[model samples]
Target: MKKLLKRIKALIRKIFQQFSSTLEPSPPPSYHSPETWIPPIPPVPSFAPQWENGLVLVCSQCTVEQFAGSSHRINRSITATEELQNWLKSRLKFDGLWGKYRVISTSCLGICPQSRVVVVLRNHLVGQQCLLVDPQSDREILYSYIKQMNQ
Candidate 1:
């Protein structure tokens, strides 16, 4: 019994020694002070945005809500999202205009009310007009809304 206890104590001491060695802190680099350090700032280029204008953020996971404060099951949001993208592409007809505007699906837009949600922004600048659309309900209406923004 004494032999077993002694062996266990020795093992515990060795384990603790290994752990303490790992816990020892290392000193920081020899930088001394930040007052002497100078940061590099690149010069601004004379250029504008590669794309023409605006952004379109579509919620790919729009769902229909039966009641308030309940988790929603995803409906035809993917189809509606694809429909909107195709419609926008066909209507725009500008080469690479579709690429300029984002046509991607999102998890949820937080407004689940028996319809798909699509958000459109004319410009990313401050105070731009952002439109929230329901593509499940008359996509033509949504198209017209975007068309107005294009003009």
Candidate 2:
């Protein structure tokens, strides 16, 4: 037992020595001399709600999205269209955007159909084109469609 323990200790020492031999020497700690250390000035950040390529608009007036704004005739599904709109807005990083895109809500879109639809204004090869969204679209479908539109 003593001989076995001795062999194990030797083996461990050999392994550690091999590891240490392969390792390079670390550099000395930096003192950060005053002339060498120049602090960077924070940049002035500019933000805009509208993307350079596309615009996403949710239909707040869609009867399926909200019961208060909608009538009994708009009860088409259990899930509201507002969830899809919020998801789209989050994916587009348009949260708290009250500048440009906020004004184009569904109530202002003028599409008063019962279907829960969204509007996508995309900059295609021929300038800006409007897209009519499908009511049956879920979060994944809406995300994919928005991604495609942006591309």
lDDT: which candidate is best? 1
Question: lDDT by residue for model 1 over 59-95, one digit each (tens)?
Answer: 5555323322346644443465667766666665664
Q: What is the TM-score (0 to 1) of candidate 2?
A: 0.41
Clashing pairs in 2: none
User: What C-alpha lDDT do the candidate models reach, one value each?
Assistant: 0.58, 0.56
What root-mean-square deviation over C-alphas does model 2 reach? Answer: 14.5
Candidate 2: Cα lDDT at 104: 40
Off by over 4 Å in 1: 23-25, 30-52, 63-78, 94-96, 120-123, 126-130, 136-151
List TM-score per model, in order.
0.54, 0.41
* Global fold similarity of model 1 (TM-score): 0.54
For model 2, residues 1-151, the per-residue Cα lDDT tens digits are 9999999999999999999988966543477765576566899988754555555666666644445564455545544556566555665565333232332455646655555565655444435444555545555665565555444
